[model samples]
Target: APFAAPRGMVATWVGHATVLVQAAGLNILTDPIWSDYASPLPPFGPKRAAQPGIKFDDLPKIDLILLSHNHYDHMDLPTLKRLWERDRPKIVTSLGNDTILKAHGIPATALDWGQSVSGAALNGLAPQAVIQCGSYEHCPDYQVHVTRNHHWGSRWGADRNRALWSSFVIETRAGNIFFAGDTGAGDMGWPMQARRYGPIRLALIPIGAFRFWKGQMRSDAHIGPLQAVDVFQRLGASTAIPIHWGTFRLSYEQWDTPPRMLELALRCAGIARKHFAPLRIGQSLPVPTVSAVPIGPKRCDDRAIRALE
Candidate 1:
């Protein structure tokens, strides 16, 4: 069931926060979860409303994996184990989560905010200053950067925030892509920090699980449609794809509400509807490269960008 790889940047929303990003000749999966339920127990917890877009066996060779956090829905151990045994892809996650994976016998590279791991380790060839492939020529060393996000992580109720959570900015030959793992609008400054990476080509952002108790309980760890637009505008990505919705019923909002709200929010924000793509499960869309003219004015001070580099 392997589909032909897109020649340029492409993304497929599997479900919830899981997205398959193909770029620079590398196949990367974000917060991969193919389990039937987002629970410790198979029969309990939020069951998947829809099956994963790409069947487990059908996934193309996965070169890398980006684990956003340790939440059950975002970090499914079974799926990780399966991919590990089959593909042995390099898994990148925020700090402390590596311990969780190590206990399960999965090796991962854990990074703190602003840290990154290169692709040379996963190339299966001798370390080289530059790795050339048919899909990417003169590609900069593929890098997965761990960036801070406004989110908490825990498996059990008592151990909240035991592991740091993160979003990722992947530097690829196609373009720098941002993956908003799972976050709420915290001070709204984190996205601006991410924007410093500049010229993001594709952004995978969350838009669901925001409406809790009809605003009785503030969703401190998730962003709504309007907030998603805010994040998109801050990141200044060429295209934004909405995720983390319609897969499991994890909040009070009705299923199918996120995408609908996202459309309206885009209109209100005066952003082009095509800029925010809400893909259905099992659907894949091409990611356009960054334009010659950047999306927004560069905000990162020259010194800050250099420091990040």
Candidate 2:
């Protein structure tokens, strides 16, 4: 298809942390990691049970790519290479990952969180500064601004906190969308994406890969189903499409547990199924035009968020 504004953005959950977000006449892929195993080695690391919903070859024309962080799941080098080879679409991600991409021959533009970069997919939205509260200076490579998140970001070895990892509040004229890479639900900024970035029409959030390794639940890794709901409400998203679940069993939760738990969370909160519909792998959903659906707000308490314990 010839390039055009995404009449509206449609999110197709390919699996794990990878998602295909088509918006503003642009087919934008977020962390397009289509590899069978999310590891540096082909047979090691985690394996996926379900295949990618949209085969690499069958993808619509990709205009842009968003990478939230550089964890292998969100920044698979092999997948990025394939995308670069196939479409050569412009890629956007956090800094340092550009080195990885360039190493793979994928020319990409990397940005820190809160930084705003716009093109056709953004619906003609312009660049905007982000609300930040961190010790690190925002990298200069991006045309966008960088904001802080309550998560950890480190690609390799001792430099875990050297480079910042964060969520994005993308501001486009058509609407705003928040893409939370892999993050736990402990931070206050989790909800601020909507308040700070404007109205969040769509949220591509992480809803899986939360492991209970070592008995103590890690607050910086990723959030579970209930926490995902908290993120939706916090971000003031009109509607939400759940990702990072059902594709691969990255954590201890049953492969199908995330969705079932998500429904239960919504039900407990008194939210209608329509308010936060979780898409099937590779399935697409439209961005909700209505902000704050009429579905009465559900009773999501901090206790419920803590229930993941």
Candidate 3:
């Protein structure tokens, strides 16, 4: 896009579900995980195949941090603490995760579904570019709402469902965005969420780490390309960007399968290939965004159309 990025809003894809969103002149991060490994250890478990796109020092000034859940891949304590110590961005997340961040000196605020913080214009700061929480989760003033996904939520304990797992319905001057942290094909809650927060301007949905355990491990956790397309249609969103792929081989599919399949499925659905994107790691796309060309019916002019079948 040739337009200058106005101070009102902007969103950048860091890697995985981690995104850098600028709204109302505020730089915000969503489900930021910068650690080398998505595990409790340093040398074992799923290690990141690609290096982080946003270096710690090079990150723009951050004013807010939105954590979607407690999964290690979604929430990294070390990364959170670093951001907290440097910028002290206000942390907004589901219930109980406040405790998790607080343990790391993050001083997070918790919110439940249907609850939210009041809207405000850019002030540059509470005195210094900081937004304060309106009230507690159970309070009537909170403005954030929680939505469900066909995914599980747990962190460092056996208490699954103990902490509320959800996605965010963010209303900015730019537009409304639905951030689906991590979810599976069944997506137990998006339909209801779409009914509530439907017509989202942009949807940041998960698209990888799904295989083998499609019915057991992450059985209800991750979605493949077709299911991802369903998510895009379910929300009635303007644009859908696929994440959670190619960064780590957490699933049984080939490393290159996601983008290829996503393109194929988008075609099969008669949706334009550009509408459903699998962006390169660390790259950003201007949202409320669309395809470059007007997509047409499958022309038998090339092998591209044949691959869709």
Candidate 4:
């Protein structure tokens, strides 16, 4: 794992939707699951196509955990229990997910779509001027806003949407970070909700598990690379890393298709490829603080639109 970025930001793809985000002197984890199978039963469900990029035991000391929803793939009870025992990190998730965690004796803070929680050090304060943080052994201060996303949740088939689904806007001294848990292109306006928090330095967007049928690029439940580029532009993110692909066999597309399509989408949208990097599992990339100018909706020519079809 990369060393924590004390005054900057660094992110490592741990596989699937799991990302080890080192920012604001805190070691934050998103949808961390180290299980071999994303199912209620072992040796069944979606078996991992690749092992965890960072071994469970080798993870840095975690300060915060962002649990997006209750999908088996995103919320593995065994891993959560282990992390709770070892690191005692502050686990934050959408409503009703806390009930699930509570049943397993894991404490977590639950928030609604527009609610937020700040670290103890911040005393529930709003984001302030950026700080020049040096090396520190503990989290300085931060805020996590539970933002809206177009997704539903159900561990079993019957309890869909009992718990809310959401993205998150993490406010830190370094910069704001957006984590789009798992979502589809709903009104394409949710990204702007996160952007309202502040300029996003790094956005972790899902760009796979969208193809439910042959030749299908997107679905009501997930966004493909084309929609993901639109999301990136809408949020005005300085940089983004694609997730939810190449880890588990969840969709019909080839394992390598999402990133390839993302490359194409970036070119079609006239955005630089480096802004939306797709890293190898366990690869770490330093996030640079860049100016985030608001961009309008994408307008690809007829030929460009047909090429994505």
Q: Which numbered prediction scores highest in lDDT against the true structure?
A: 4
Number of clashing pairs per prediction, in order:
0, 14, 13, 0
Evaluate all candidate structures by whole-model CA lDDT and list the values in order: 0.83, 0.68, 0.68, 0.88
Put down candidate 2 lDDT per residue, 1-309, tens digits, no spaces: 222243466677787767776555546677787888877676987888899988888888675677767777777888777777777777776777677678777886677655656452222332232223111112111222334556676656776865556666655444666777777877556567545757778877767766666554434677877788878877778878888878766778677767777877886778887878877777777666746755566666777655544
lDDT tens readout by residue for model 4, 155-261? 98799889988999998878889999999998988999888998999999999999998889799889999999999988989999999999999989989889988
Candidate 3's TM-score reads 0.81
Question: Quick one: best TM-score, which candidate?
Answer: 4
Off by over 4 Å in 2: 1-6, 120-147, 213-218, 295-309
Q: Where does model 4 exceed 4 Å of error?
A: 121-139, 293-307
lDDT of 1 by residue, 1-309 (tens): 223243478888898999888886778899999999999887999999999999898899888899999999999999999999999988999999999999999999998999877776545444454544434323326878899889999999798988999999988777888999999989888787787877898889999998778543228999888789889988878798999999998998778777877766665566777788799898888876675323333344555334222
Q: Give residue 70's lDDT in candidate 2 (0 to 100).
A: 71
Q: CA lDDT of 219 in candidate 4?
A: 94
- Candidate 3 lDDT tens digits, 1-309: 112154234556788888887654546688888898988877887898888777878887676677888888888899998888898777778888888777777787788766666433222223212234432211112124566666677865777877777777776545567788777756355645644754566678887776664333234678777678777777777777787877765778778777787777776667787666777767766665422334467433347555533
**All-Cα superposition RMSD per candidate:** 7.6, 7.3, 5.8, 3.4
- TM-scores for all candidates? 0.88, 0.81, 0.81, 0.91
Distance (Å) between predicted and true CA of 183, model 2? 0.5
